[model samples]
Target: MVSTALQDLFGGKAAEAVLLALFHHGEAYGRSIARDFAVSLDSVQRQLDRFERSGTLVCKRQGRTLVYTWNSKSRLASRLRDLTGVVYDGLDPQTKEQLFAERRQPRAKDKPVIRR
Candidate 1:
């Protein structure tokens, strides 16, 4: 997991984590963000609400899910994105890899693993 520097800067760990996830992963729902960080869903949802209220993010319903994305029109959006990029760049290799890892690939059913 990334460090708490974001929490220090943003004043809330859940908000920081949610912002990082959205900034890196693009449109995500609260549960996915919570799952990604292994945090409480309620906390993530609250932060999402806060971001929406503050105009830092925007949300729309996609089926039953409420998807969130950066508000590109918001004046602070670009600055925050740049800050996230800077923070991501300065992270240690392992944390950086984890932060940007691809986790949405399709899997075949009943597939067996092959060992090297």
Candidate 2:
């Protein structure tokens, strides 16, 4: 039987994608997550809002964009990050590759782009 663990863990596939984007990259915005997952921006934004309200995430204004990251000060957020890490560790390589195709997002002003 095909396990629906991912959807069960995240409540929905779209929500899982949004969380995984943040987990993989440490931060993300609604539009970027939605575009990466091919889900609607509104759906991603709703998930973001839900997480933010639950104290699992915090968002700061980067100009007009609201960038979300785990709420470091909250223990619940920390535990959730750890859980997400475990789930991420179990994802197949192909799934990770596709979900994280774009690592680029609009940088905050004056954020230096480091080249390898």
Best by TM-score: 2
In lDDT terms, how accurate is model 1? 0.76
lDDT of 2: 0.78
The Cα local distance difference test for each model comes to 0.76, 0.78
User: In candidate 2, what are the lDDT values of residues 28-48, reduced to their tens digit?
Assistant: 999888887888898889989
* lDDT tens digits, residue span 1-116, model 1: 65666788878769778877876667789988887787899999988898899888999999999999999899887788788767655666666456555564454664322111
TM-score of candidate 2 against the unseen true structure: 0.82
- The 10-residue segment of model 2 with minimum total lDDT is 107-116
In order of appearance, the predictions have TM-scores of: 0.81, 0.82
Q: Mark the regions of model 1 whose C-alpha exceeds 4 Å error after superposition.
A: 100-102, 105-116
